[model samples]
Target chain A: MGCEEFELLLNGYIDGELKDPDLKRVEKHLAGCPPCQKLVRDYQRLKEVTAEMKFKNPPQEIWDSYWQRVFHRITRGVGWVFFLVGAVAVAGFAVYEFATDPAVEALQKLIVFAIFVGLGLLLISVIWERVKASKTDKYKEIER
Target chain B: MSLTEKEIVSKCQRGETEYYEQLVNKYKRSAYFYALGMVGSVEDALDLSQEAFIRAYRSIKRFKPQYQFKNWFFRILTNLCISHLRKKRRRRVEVSTEDKEGRTMPLPDDHFNPHLLLERKEIMRQLWKALSELGNKHREIILLRDFQGLSYKQIYEILEIPVGTVMSRLHQARSRLRVKMADFM
Candidate 1:
């Protein structure tokens, strides 16, 4: 292998990562090249030295508490949001289908009215909650 | 199919949520260390890794089993830590608490006497600093190849990069570290 190629692949060879053709070239080059041989040895020595450094694992509770707050609660809220949206979408589709169909006019009006009432109540609750939340935000965020 | 980690991951696609604890436990140490290596503190590493795991767990439902879970989760952890570090730097109110001895000493000298153990600790600290100073890509590749002991293909899979990229990055990372060995160890 050329000195350039050997330099490129030297680390891999030390890690026993060099494949056949490249490995062959490196071996052939090492047989004649003292600098290349020293380079390989030094690479190995450095790797061994650094390998002694150990990466530390984080403690267990931080992961547990952090995720629960960041993701668990967030997902739980988002899950409800998704369900509400899906329920609304499907209900709207059904009501439209029932109303627009000649054979289902009775079913359509009843379902549509039910959806309207339910949606109205839900919107009122959501609006009230949001207003309350905004009032809290005004209080809490104002401090910042 | 190379019977990729994707296969195991796909199995986790839904019911996978229940089994996620397995994946978390498996990656917990290495993932934590990788984060620790960058953030430079046990506390930050712990916080970051935990956060990383939670993010991974939250998105477990969307994880495709046909893909390798190793890379999938690691990418999330890597992204979370990097982003957290960026935001953290922005909120940089905490002036560094200087090591009390660092002010008067060179910081690496444990003693004037010949103690191999002290020397080894100094070496490890140096290496840790060297690894931390590497650019993010080099740091990730070294963690994957050396610390995590991933094969070339697996590193590529984890990185979602070409094999050539993995090889070159690995080379770059090692060369950078090799040059910094004195500073590191």
Candidate 2:
């Protein structure tokens, strides 16, 4: 194998992931290549040091409440969904009643209708802005 | 009695929400450590890992039984961390007000002092500093293989890449780390 090809197999060899025939081929190349031999030693040492470095364990209290926190999040999520839907439905009904009521003055009805329209337009604008921001957001597509 | 991951998932799918506690208890440490390694912050790691579990619970029906629960759950987690990192970089760029040829430049995270979490050994601190300096992809492969002790095949499953890709990426990642730790060597 040429140097490039040997270099490709070096990782596998160091990782013990190479099959016997490929391992033999790599060993044969390393025998005549001092640079590749040095590279292997360096890689092996790097791996050893990395393996020895472990993350510190978190406190037990975090573990104790971990599941409870997740449970609360799930419940809170469901609650928010219900709350938003109910709020929207109630607002829509109130607006419809106010707009259709014949007992109210003409100016009063016009002002109420205008207020609802303004609120509706504001909501749409905010939603549109959010959608546009998400489109341009660099983090939108992460590697799966 | 201990249940297999698949069995636990199936029970959760059957509307037994309580069964999920078993799954959470089983993999919470692994999930938290994986996130900590990826994001370099303990608080964010705990939040992200738990969020991943909640997401998994919501989407368990989409998970085919052939897939291992751990791999399926980890995919959700990695995607979340990657997204979080991008947002964090964007926030830093905004705060620094440094633009290089119309592209935003992320500021170094000088505030993220991992020494509080890690032991005071110089080598350990150097290892973490070197690991944090690595790009997300390189750091992820190293964390999975070295820190998490996952096999290449398991990485292939989680990352949805070929086994050859895992080996090559791991090689590149470790080579970069070797360069970073040249002072110690």
Candidate 3:
């Protein structure tokens, strides 16, 4: 194998991921190649140095309250969903009643109807864009 | 007997929400550190990691019992972190200063002499800086392999990439890191 080819496997060799024929081939190349030997040594040192590094620990209180925080968020999320659904339903019924009432002025009803129509169109446009974006998102497949 | 991770997940799926505490406690550190590595801020990391767990809990029903919880949970965390970074990029926010200030070096060992401790601390600081300077993809692979000590297979599972890709990416990442650390080495 050429040096370049061996270089690709160097990491595998260092990481002990190489197997059988590939491992033997790398071993043979490293036996006679001083530069490759130096590369391996340097990579090993890099790994060793990195292995010593650790993130400073956060306080114990973060751990103590982590679950409580998550639970609170989850419950709050559910509560918000219910609240929004109920609010929207009630508002929609109220608007419907006002728009249909005989005593309401025609111009006022038209204006309110137009406002809801505009809002609906805007919501549909946003949802459509989000769907299209999700479909076209290059990172979606890798991330999810 | 203590319940296994799979059992805990199964219970969670069945509506025993309290059982999820085990999972949160088990992975909180890893989740936080991984987010810290990605976003480079303590506050963001804490928020993102906690958000990941909440997201996981809400979607526990979709998680299959056969899959490793760690892999699935990390997939969520990774998405959140990457999205956070992208948004930060769009905003053109400068976070490097905060990153440096927020990170602390490992405490010096009492066993080591003062001079050696100082040298070690300097080396660690340089390494951390070089790591943070790496491109997003490179830094991610390094964080997964070196920082988290995840196996290549586990990384493939979490990243949803081929094992071959994982190996090549890790190699490329380490190579870049090596170049960045050349001055000190």
Candidate 4:
């Protein structure tokens, strides 16, 4: 191949991506061409520079943001769960305040607190259910 | 280098925004480097990356679910880089057969000391001076194939051109780069 032809195929040949016939032809030409040989060598070296170039990782927070973004998305789903539980708990508190007097039992406050804890756990469970409910592939197809 | 192309597209089309970020973060460095390499500015790289992501997000709807995600992402990035380069109207010197000696590839400047980093930063000032100095067609082909590691077929796919065009452009691009880097050799 002359300098012009060799110049056109030099890169493809260096990358080992030329068609078979084209490859052999380029190889045959390179066997006797000084400029083409030099061209091939230079392309190889430049490819090396590219290959050797360092791979820099993005910042750690980017990864964190990846999961955090996912988690935050889940959090919004959980928010409704919390809202429901908080509402029930508030209602229970209001009922207790208006219904029997506080002096009814020594353990009354403790029982009420325990009920609130249960209510909170129920809220979390509900959130988990909602997340599980939407975990289907069909819903996964939906974007925010 | 990434999830199989189909899987990526399906995941994205399925409204997998977070899954798409994997694509972003995966190629972020290359996208960033290409932008930085071509535009010779970090600000441009940042802008280009954002633009690439936004563009990718918007047009992803048109992407066939059967295509490769990396290739598709690269298509967006390279085009953005090209467009970004065009809008700014920069020039790259045609790399010709020149004395390409002693252009030692230092460890990438990411590891340099603050002072060296400054020097390295300035290095970009003249670095793209070589590549940027090339003609427009030569510039795009070279940057896409060499710096971007795109296959001829992939280049054709991305650019929507014939494979023959990819090969010729690649050859010209590499020749030009060799000429530009000739001084360093």
Candidates, ranked, DockQ: 2, 3, 1, 4
Q: After aligning candidate 4 to the native by TM-score, how far in Å is the CA of B1 from where it should be?
A: 18
Candidate 3 matches the true fold with a TM-score of 0.77
Provide DockQ values for all models, in the order shown: 0.14, 0.40, 0.27, 0.11
**Residues B1-185 of candidate 2: C-alpha lDDT, one tens digit per residue:** 88877888899999788899999988999999889888988888998999999998888888899878888888889889889888787766655545667665565685236564456578778888898889999988888887787777778888899989998888788878988888877
Model 4 score (lDDT): 0.65
Please give the distance, in angstroms, between residue A3's alpha carbon in candidate 2 and its true position after superposition.
Answer: 3.9
Q: What is the Å distance of residue A6 in model 3 from its true position? A: 1.3
RMSD values for the candidates in order, in angstroms, are 10.0, 5.1, 9.1, 16.2
Per-residue error (Å), model 3, residue B2: 1.6
Fnat across every predicted model, in order: 0.22, 0.52, 0.52, 0.25
Q: Which stretches of candidate 2 lie over 4 Å from their true place?
A: A30-34, A87-111, A122-144, B97-107, B111-114
Residue B66, candidate 1: alpha-carbon lDDT: 60
For each candidate, what is the lDDT? 0.67, 0.84, 0.82, 0.65
Candidate 2 clashing pairs, residues 3+ apart or interchain: none
- For all predicted structures, in order, the TM-scores are 0.64, 0.83, 0.77, 0.59
Which tens-of-lDDT digit does each residue in B6-31 have in candidate 4?
A: 67767877777667666666766667
Docking class of 3: acceptable
Q: Which residues of candidate 1, in runs, are more than 4 Å off? A: A55-144, B1-11, B88-120, B183-185
Q: What lDDT tens digits, residue by residue, belong to model 2 across residues A111-133?
A: 87788789989999999999998
